[model samples]
Target: MNTLRLAALEALLLTDPLQKVDAVNALHLELPVGAEQSIQDPGGIPGRPSHLEFVLPQKVPRRSVHTLQGRAALVHSLAHIEFNAINLALDIIWRYPNLSDRFYGGWLTVAKEEALHFSLLQAHLSTLGFNYGDFPCHDGLWEMAERTKDNLLARLALVPRTLEARGLDACPVVREKFAQAGDQQAAQILDVILRDEVGHVALGNYWYRRLCREQERCDFDTYQQLAKQHRAPRLRGPFNRPARLEAGFTERELQALEEQA
Candidate 1:
């Protein structure tokens, strides 16, 4: 039977950006979760479009949002993040088996929402006279995914708790950039992304704590240990404190993050 996790794996392997988005949106969430299924690594895990120019993070040029092409490039960069987010969500669901059914469903839901975010950004980019692949991008998000692929705990800790959490801080800033650039539509899209991303990160925090309990570890200490072992990026501020709190970060975690800044 074609299970939900299996379906997500298929979607992850789709090379075309629009096709992958459509596949995720069309997924049968009502299907079996296949929690115990141990699907083989089919290679080409995250199929990429041929035209995408993957450049080093530092090599990707930053453009002023005030210019038309620059705004489009910024929008393209966001769309790329959403696209990778969809893949990250799908990868977690399929790669980790025997987890709680909620885990798979949670990530699948995230994948669908990420697809929506990508679609919104992609459509907005068109109005700016560009498409998703119109600009160079970095694979930093997926690089972290790769580093944590062998460990589900690390994946949750670094990818969602760490990487995606950074998005919470950046979204409002990016939204304002678009608003100041007179792109009200893009700004509105960011609002939607921010609202949904808070829940997604909360979900990660929930599961991370659950796993910590099962592993007989303190969540905070384990997070610090994992962060150091994984060499996760340092947290910076000004953080979106309210959003972080809404997303399930405790007061102490907020303090720790602030201390890190």
Candidate 2:
């Protein structure tokens, strides 16, 4: 039987970006969840395009949003993030088997939404005369995925709750930049992403707490320990309090984030 997890694995291994997006969008959600199966690591986990160049985060030159090329770069950067997001969602679905079936289903939905975000950004990029690979990007998201590969709890705590949560804080500022640059279309695309990402991060919070409960660990404390253990980036502020609240972050979490600021 072509199970849900295996199908997600197939999509994850697709190298061509558009094809991967299409495959994820077309994923069969009705298939059996196959929650108890332990799938082997097939390597080549996240197949990315060959032409895309990855530079260190600092090496990627900053561009102004005022120029057409600069706006294109901005759109391309968001597209790249969405692309990595699709893989991250799929990775969560297939990599950690034996969880509740809802866990896989929730992430599969996220994978499709990530695909939609990518397609939206890609279309906008085309209007700006650029493609995803036309701009240089960093691999920070997938790097965190690699680091959290072995532990499902760590993956939940870090990727969605930690890394993906950062998107919640950043989306408003980035969207405002697009709007200020008169790229309202790009700003609208960001709006869609932000709306969907709130739910994605909420899923992370839900599952992270579920695991912490199963292990009898305090959710906030465990998250703090995992962040330090994984060497996760320190979160800076102007944090999105409303979005974080909607995404299931507790009051204490918000206070800690504020204190971190």
Candidate 3:
């Protein structure tokens, strides 16, 4: 299926939601790497679903899940995350073709899982009289993606290990909120996300350490250096230690996170 990176670029070039995901689904990473040195960085926002109006994170309102619109709002936010996640995966695949082969294939797996999460959330949103792009969202995630576009290791340190790992710590709290609101289905969906996210975060940890080793840098210290160098967001806690451990964070790393976040 063409060059794998180009297939990712095709996914990133299609603005429609389903079309973009279909392009991702069509990817075959085993194909020979084509003239990757010639990939042109696309302009405007990377292929995104139409009608997704993005606002600053502070501008997006928070709502409780006690009411129908409230529940839909919360779920819409998650769906938006998954959608951007698809773009992030695609962006990394094409933007850094110079990385190890496993890097590209690993991100393909992430893109597929993100598509599943988005599809699941889209279906759930429908039952609540909502669909994706039905509410305003934020660009914090992609902002970081754009910031780290030129640095693959920084992308690994911040996007996946830092931001995505934050999701692991948040899942239980969000699930409990859904459960309390009597939306068992939404709560169950968070469980599904939690399961898959562990692997995704694990991938980040694996790559982060591998890259550090390859560069002869200390893992924990290098993460700190990158976080400082890139202005990665400060972590906060009530950290889900078990989930973090399962996702491959070392105890010292966890302590560093706690100290700084």
Query: Quick one: best lDDT, which candidate?
Result: 1
Clashes of each: 0, 0, 1
Candidate that beats the other on TM-score, 2 or 3, i.e. the better one: 2
**What would the per-residue lDDT of candidate 2 be over residues 107-224, giving only the tens digit for each residue?**
9999999999999999989988888899899999999999999999999999999889999999999999999999889889999999999999999999999999999999999998
Sort order, lDDT high to low: 1, 2, 3
Name the runs in model 2 displaced over 4 angstroms.
none
* Two-way lDDT contest, 2 vs 3, winner: 2
| Whole-model lDDT values for every prediction | 0.93, 0.92, 0.87
Give me the displacement of residue 63 in model 1, in angstroms: 1.0
If scored against the real structure, what TM-score would every candidate get?
0.98, 0.98, 0.95
What is the C-alpha RMSD, rounded to one decimal, of candidate 3?
1.6
TM-score (C-alpha, index-matched) for candidate 1: 0.98
Model 1 lDDT tens row, 147-251: 999999999999999999999999999999999998899999999999999999999999999999999999999999999998998988999999999999999
What are the per-residue Cα lDDT tens digits for candidate 3 across 115-189? 888888988999989888899999889989988898889999999999999999999999999999999999999
Q: Which stretches of candidate 3 lie over 4 Å from their true place?
A: 33-37
Q: Report RMSD for candidate 1.
A: 0.9
Worst 10 residues of 3 by lDDT: 29-38
Per the 3 Å backbone cut-off, how many clashing residue pairs does candidate 1 have? 0
